[model samples]
Target: MTFSIPNLLSLFRLATAPLLALVFLVPENQNIANIAATALFLLAASTDFWDGFIARRINQSTSLGALLDLLADKLLIVTALLLLLDAERAPVGACIFIVGRELLMSALREWVAQNGKSSTVRVIAVGKWKTGLQMTAVPFLFYAGDLWALNTLAVGVWLLWAAAALSVWSMLSYCLALWRNE
Candidate 1:
C-alpha cells in the first residue's frame, strides 16, 4: 500500500471519473457539461500513461498502483460509455458489446490467474491500440464539435468501432494464449 506519486496520479484519475460523469449527467449543466467532461476525461486518460511511466522510472510500481490504474480506466470509460448511450450519441448495441466484452475478459483473466496461468494473458499490442482509439474517441464524442465541416461525432463513432474491433481481437488473442498454455 505504498502511496507513491504514480499511485497518486491513479487516485486523481479515479477521482475524476465520477466528476466527469456528473458533468454530463447533471441536467442543470447541460450547456457547458460536454466541454468540461471532455477536459476532465482527457486529463485523466493522459495520467494513465504518465503514472505507468513514472512508476517504472522511479521503481515505484506496486500491485496496488496497477490495480488502481486499471480500476480508474474502467470507471472512466464505463462512465463515458453510459453517458454516451443515454444521450444517444453512441449506439446502445455497440456500448453493450464493448461492456460485455470487458466483463468477459475480466472474468477470463481471473480464471487464468486462479489456474496459475496469469502470465499467459499478457497485454497485446492490439489492446494498446484499442485503448488509444478508445481514449481518442471518447473525448471527441464528448466535445461533439465540428471542425472544417467534419463532424466529431461521426469520426468518434468510427473510432469507437475500430477500437471495439481491436478490443475483441485482443481479447481473443489473450484467450487463445491461455488456452494454448493449458
Candidate 2:
C-alpha cells in the first residue's frame, strides 16, 4: 500500500479516536478533555474531506485509501456518538436511529455487492449535509458540560434529530434509486 501525505493524515486521525474516548473517561480533567476531544474530532472530520480531495487531485486514489477514509469517518462518528450516549447528552432514540441506519446501509451495500451490482455508493448531497449536521452536533454535545453559558447541548440534540431525519430521507432516496435501477 502506497502511503501518501493525505492517507497518513487519515491514519493519524484514526489513531486519535481512542484518545478522544479516553479524554471523556477522565472526570477530573473533563473540561480540558472535552476541549481536546472536540479539537481531535474536528481535525478528524476535516481529514475526511482533505483525503478525498487530495487523492482525487493527485490521482493517488487507491482502494485501500478509500477504505481507510470510510473506516476513519465511521470510527470517528461512532466513537463520538458512544461518548455522547455515555454522557447522556444524546437521546437514546437518536443514538439507536443513527446506529440502526449505519447497520442497515452496510447490509444493503453488502447485498448489492454480492449481487454484482455497482460497488460504488455515491455519497449524495443530502448525505453530506447529514454528516455535517452530525459532526457539528456531536462535538457540541460532548463539550456541553464544560460550557454552561449557552444551551449548546440542547441545540446539539435538536441538530441530532435533524440529522436523523435527513439520514432516513437520504436512505430512502438511495433505496429508491437502487430499486429503479433494478
Candidate 3:
C-alpha cells in the first residue's frame, strides 16, 4: 500500500471526478462551467495514461497502484459520462451500453480474481481502444460547443457510439477468452 507517484496521480484523478459534477451546479455560468469541466476531464484522462506509463517505466507497478488506477479510471469515466448524459450531450442508448458494459466487466473481473483466474481476463486491445475513444469523446461532450468550424457535440456523439461499440466488443472478447481459459 505504498503511495507511489503513480498511485498519487491516480488518486488525483479520482479526486477530480466529483469536481466535474460541481462545475455543472452553476447553471447561470453554463459556458464557463462547460469549459472548466472539459479541462478537468482532459487533465484527469491524461493522468490515466501517465500513471500507467510511469508505473511501468519506473518499475513501481504494485497491486495497490493497479487497483487505484483502475478505480480512478472507472470513476472519472463514469462521472463524465453521467454528466454528459444529464446535460443531454450524450445519447441515452450509448450511456446505457457503456455503463452497463463497465459494470459487467468489473463484476466479471472480481469473479475471476476470486477464483484465482485473474490472468484469464487481462485487459485486451479492444478494451484499450474503448478507453481511448471514451477519453477522446468525453472532453468534446463536456465542452458541447463549436470549435471554429467544427461542431464538437456531433463529433463527441459519434465517438461515444464508437466507444460503446468497442465496449461491447471488448466485453465479449474478454468473456470468450475467460471461458476458453476456464
Worst 10 residues of 3 by lDDT: 19-28
Q: What is the C-alpha lDDT of each candidate?
A: 0.85, 0.81, 0.91
Measured on C-alpha atoms, candidate 1 has an lDDT of 0.85
lDDT of 3 by residue, 58-104 (tens): 99999899889889989998999888888889999998999999899
Off by over 4 Å in 2: 145-149
lDDT (Cα, 0-100) at 133 in candidate 1? 87
| Pick by TM-score: 2 or 3, better one | 3
Q: Write down the RMSD of all candidates, one decimal each.
A: 1.3, 1.9, 0.9
Tens digit of per-residue lDDT, candidate 2, span 79-157:
8899888878898888788777777777877888788775445678988888888888887887775365777788889
Q: Candidate 2 at residue 13, lDDT?
A: 71
Q: After best superposition, candidate 3 residue 26: deviation in angstroms?
A: 2.7
CA lDDT for candidate 3: 0.91
State TM-scores per candidate. 0.95, 0.91, 0.97
TM-score of predicted model 2? 0.91
lDDT of 1 by residue, 1-182 (tens): 67889999999988997788788878576658888888889999999899999999989988898789888887888889998988878767667767877888889878887988878977679888878888999988897878688898999999888878887888888888877888
